[model samples]
Target chain A: MVESKHSWKAWLYLAPAIVLLLVFTVWPIINTVRMAFLDDYSGLEEVGGTVFNFGVGNFIKVVQYQRFLDCLKTTSILCIATVPISTILALLIAVALNSIKVLQKFLQTVFFLPYVTNSIAIGMVFAAMFNIVGSFLGTENELVVTAGVINNVIEFFGGTHVNWINVGSTYAANIFVMVVYIVWNALPFKILILLGGLQSINKQYYDAAKVDGTSKGRILRKITVPLLSPMLAYVVITGFIGGFKEYTSIIGIFGETMGPADASGRLNTMVGFIYDALASNKQGRASAAALILFGIILVVTLINLQVSKKKVHY
Target chain B: MADNNIVVMHERQMNKVKTASKVGGVAGKVLTYLFLTIMALIILFPFYWMIISSLKTLDEYRMSVPTFWPRVVMFSNYAEAFTVGKLGRLFLNTVIVGLVSTLLSLVITVISAFAFARLEFKGKNILFAGLLATMMIPGELFTITNYGTVTSLGWKNTYTVLIVPFLVSVFYIYLLRQNFLQIPNELYLAAKVDGTSDIKYLWKVMIPLALPTLISITILKMTGAWNSYIWPRLVANDGVHSLITNGLRNAFTETTGDVNYPVQMAAVALVSAPLFIVFIFLRKYIMKGVSRSGIKG
Candidate 1:
């Protein structure tokens, strides 16, 4: 009777959150699936009381679209390329920071700086670093400009300046720039998590290794990595999920184009594809694309979990 | 005598090994520091560049070789960026949205958390599990339908649109619930025996005990408002309702397709200042909130 009395009061307390969640979250999820199945469904037309046939038309359209394929490819390449590289780099950095006592806190704070930054703002800063500032010189408007800081640094190192995200830049070059920016943005949080994991690890293991005269490399591989596997798995799984949804970082660099001016949609990811569809009022297609992305993330996450379960040591 | 000689030789060999190991350890430490210093520089360079680039003149900024430091520092660019980007208005809008949404969300979170934490609710376990499951689905999926929902409601170009839909963050509710549960059940039971009302008890005891988590939630929610771009861009991107992130996007590009790099950088720097300040002052809370959630994606 007491518990029953509290039930209604609990409902009262939960009313506001539940109401908003139902409208905004639960309904939206169901509506996304519903809209995805509705062939050629326009939200505007639906509001005007137009009935729509339900079919696989939207999914078919999303699959057949060339831009969507490009988005899929871009997303996959980014995920594959970035996750391993960032994970390894962050692992090494975290381990190094863990080993050292000198300036450890300072370096950790510095490394964690990007975690607090606005991605768009930092993305713009990255864009400027790689951007070529040009001026139209003659009547023909031949562009003359200064190389960006990245290019200047390359030249200083006796390498030629490459057009990174500019017009006429190669796909590989553009992807390279995006990878660098993504990795830079990703490092701080990973370092934070891994460092925390490293710190919480017992010192007895290291002391035992030292007594046995174990080499640093062997200890890192055999002891440190196995102990830190759980955090690494978490980071890698989250990294893939985040990489699939890569949008704002691209927006920060390329504005709304998602690519260089001459090559719009070249660097577009799955989320960007959905956004483009929504922007054009292709709600059904956008929903389908979003579902596709969700499916991919689900499959990937499951695979990651399976692999981690087998390989991760406790 | 031969055994003594063997012992002396063994001791000499051990000393040599000890010296070698000591040297190796020093070298390892030096290498670690060197690597960390370089990584730190790589991380910090963009910020340094953003500052220097913001201070340079347009001509200087466009020079074939980028200047490590601006030859002529342009202090007026910040003023120009402030007016040109209409940063003041954007700042005002962001503050309004951030505060209103954070406060309202806090109330909802506290009450909902209390309910889930203490009150014997039917279907409580299922409801909490369902909420946690939603964290797996990408938020972009929601945007597709929510855009339609908001548009049908005629929420375009309004602060209400910006503040209302995001008022119920399942993550914050979950975070606060965990915090509320940490308050000993004895206190609640004692209050109940004394005929104290649940809401009154929650307000007086639970909230004060869970202040740290509440504070963390507030900071995280405020920062979320500051960093949010996608949803706001979808529904309320007009001049009046646009938040700072959307406001800064495309604000500096000229009609000729040339961006004013210096002024844009200055605008970015200004836009980023508050977040950096918040981070510097409230880093512990922010970090605690982030690490606790671990679902930022």
Candidate 2:
């Protein structure tokens, strides 16, 4: 390619972003790959040496780690469960909001409120809403009650009172609480995006259908559903991507512990597990886990792009 | 007489149908509003609960049946949050980090966006495409190595650790670049013919044209800094250095004694109020920013 004469000035302008990107993004990725291939780099600093095993040992260790597997399962369950539920709910909300004449902006602002608040802070509120704990330091730690609205409803429906937060053999109840929180948190953005998509649709389509005396359900199915596919795809892809990295909300509800401890006392998500590994000087394992997560995200995103290309109307 | 009677009957039937449809229209509007109001209440309830719980006393907060509103409003809880949780320091730290990083990041983003948009350089497309590819990779991957780099640099517990890594966002650069491209190249050429420097032309002309996108970036970046928890918690989750979000993790909890849930809720409320106010007032900018990112709706 013929280079521009102004390449010098352009480089000057691009220097800051390039430098920061190299340090923070590019170099870190290279380092992660290198570390993931090697053994743990613990104590190498003191010895002024480097570890270079350069095998699949780290990957093997990551897959074999029970906590990592559990964390992956938890993450997958959350992603699979929340993404569709939230997308459908958001789509419905958006369609309703779009049809409305009054208080649309007001409702929009209310929905978007969750997007602005810190996840951890809101997670705390959600955690408290789901359970009523006994007095701190009380010997009657067993005196915990189902103070949360959802658990109370469950109790009313002839279901036994369960510690929703501290999930035991039944992971369903705990997963349910997590899904609800995530769905609520995810709604505002998805709704906003879907609303935008719905609004972008031309009025002529609806008018033509109305002239033909098309029912509301038919109009939505024939007109709204096809046109809104692009946004719906976008929401699903991003939502799934976000769901995989689930960390802070868990921390918000369960403190730094992430969730209620299992038999091994490991309540980790994918990101949380990575953080824990890195913190505890298990650099190789952390890097491997991170790289695995990256691969999954990349695959999921690519698959979504491919699927949407076939399905999305525009 | 028969023809006249048929005409009257048709007219009556048409009028009745019109009246039924009119009533249905009114009912539909009412139903729409009813649905919206219920959803709005559900969406807004957590924020309401946060504020009310903050105002309740310890006993009221832990009641067998939660009160919809506080029995007694504890205004002192706010004061207690400030002093007891050292929220004043956390607020200051958060504000400093947010403002400084946002301003610095803006400078980098504007210049880089200008280069990619207006300036023609070798491999410009390739470089930009490479950067775009990085967006596909989840950011958690970077934290793995960036944490090690920061710790090695002895930047832990320092503002440098908190602010430096995140000061450049590829997405923001891409957004500003798109915005800058909309400004005609003729203006830049016209200024260049006058012997104006690139930086001078940028300051005097490009910035004014792209002011809306610039404002969007600033507000979003600031809000991002305000809401950041995990990274800050990882590197600087210590006294004075802790961000407001990280600081609230367990600041109001009793270390070895009874925990006052109300007081902690008060701390959360304190941390949340600024963002809520910002969201309310500058919502247009935030909404516009998202819409402009080519992800409209």
Candidate 3:
């Protein structure tokens, strides 16, 4: 190594990223890990003075918290529903647009617009849409001013006017809307990568399939999809990881009701729960909840990496 | 006659196969268009509503029949939001945070990426892999410690809290490193022979070649900083100011009994517009970074 060219300057350039990561990322992470065990928020004990210290009580308390279990379930449910559904929708759009001759770029732009928009803005809009009265497309609200619009739609469905956010059914509805927003947000990425992978497949395969009397559906399943599995794996696992880390919409959707609320509430995500605990200054509880959420996501991500490395069909 | 019949039979079979495929293909196309239209509506409706709601007047927003489309378009909602929240200053703060952090992060990551991808050193692979694993560690796990650290340093309500903590992004480095590694090793060998040191070689050789990746990563950084709700919420969502999300949230809650929907929508639209423009050109990179980075920010 010493015989190699002067590498002294490399460290000089490396110093900034390293020092900041150490000070900001690594140190805070270490401190957070330590805080997870502590019971009280008053302050932790130190060797010479009052400092944050070790306690196992918070972890024990986290396990017993009903909201923890609820959040874990909600996150899993959200991911399970969103990942596969969104991927297929995105893939279908990609393949269709890819197959077309004109309007491809225009359609792509339309589909990809939501992801670029601020989640707050998007969420605010969705909230209004979900609002019975002021919502844009929803027919349940009193507003559409068009006498028969919302009423007819509701009557058509054998239902009455109902609030999308505050109703008893808002839990599942909330997750669904959030999934819609997230999937829309995540679609362009999935579409682009999948498109890149799609284009990479040799035209020879399709030409050969035609010669062999294989149908388009057969080609899609046996060729296009299998060939695109690696990209699919990439999207799915990342979706799983990204799904649980939500914030902007949830806060905007159900403003500050994430705690001690009934079923139709956001007492379902660790991120929401952390906000809930922190709101009331229960720092210890927040730390405990944050640690649990961290552990779940990290484990899933690690599993994803390992699984994709083994099973991705690339 | 037998040979003709055989050839005709083969042609018939092929036609059958082709026709069978065509039926499903037509149905699939119809369904695909139907689904795409629905999704397109879902995707575009909220943005459309936001824009319209921003233009809606206060009375129209609160009327008996909800103004689906504002009857009398009031452009003042945005004007009011802009002035009320000191939005120009907030925009300046946001731009400063986004651009500075992005450029700083890019510069830092570019160097580290070269080191990991090309530089041969003790524990290089271990450190790089460890960094990837660290990417899985959630930011929430670190926020408490970060808060405490920021407060103790007396950096609360200061730029340090806004900028310093986020200067290094593991995900960005990972993306850049992967792009860097794709460059042929022979180029480095060539540079070495010319007496260009590794750092200089990286600057003079790898950086120029890897321009696209850096550009994409910069866009990603910009978008991430622009839409950062939580960190700003934690650090700046209080007495003096909060960025877009905070401002919107305050606006949303301020008119509690009245809940000025138009004004809040106006604020939301205003904040979202800048990055929305950037999204048009950087669409490719933005999608790639967000979807495939595997390392979430």
Top-scoring candidate (DockQ): 1
Query: lDDT scores for all predictions?
Result: 0.87, 0.79, 0.70
Task: Considering chain A alone, report the TM-score of candidate 2 relative to the true chain A.
Answer: 0.89
- Lowest summed lDDT across 10 adjacent residues in model 3 chain A is found at A142-151
Error of 1 at B272 (Å): 0.5
**Which candidate's lDDT is highest?**
1
What's candidate 2's DockQ score?
Answer: 0.43
Each candidate's TM vs. the true structure? 0.94, 0.91, 0.84
- Report the Cα lDDT for candidate 3: 0.70
Runs in model 3 lying further than 4 Å from the true structure: A1-7, A39-55, A133-159, A167-170, A208-218, A259-268, A275-284, A301-312, B1-31, B62-70, B184-204, B238-241, B254-258, B288-297
Estimate, for each residue in A82-156, the C-alpha lDDT of model 3 and write its tens digit.
888888987887777666655667777787676676766566666665554333344665344322223335655
Docking class of 2: acceptable
Tens digit per residue, CA lDDT, model 2, A69-132 = 9999999999999999999889888988999867788888888888877887787777767754
Report the C-alpha lDDT of model 1 over B153-245, residue by residue, as the tens digit: 998889999999989988888888888888898888889889998879988999998998998888888888888888888888778888998
lDDT digits (tens) for residues A217-288 of candidate 1: 999999999999999999999999999998888888888877888887788889988988899888999999
Error in Å for residue B222 of model 1: 1.2
Chain A of candidate 3 compared with the true chain A, TM-score: 0.81
Better DockQ candidate (1, 2): 1
Summarize candidate 2's per-residue lDDT along B1-297 as a digit string, tens digits.
Answer: 999997687567556655756766688778878887888888887778778888988877766666778989998988988888888888999899999999999999989999899888879899999999898887778998888788889999999898899888899899988888888888888887888888899999989988988888888877777788878878886675898877787574321112466677788888888887887788898887875553211
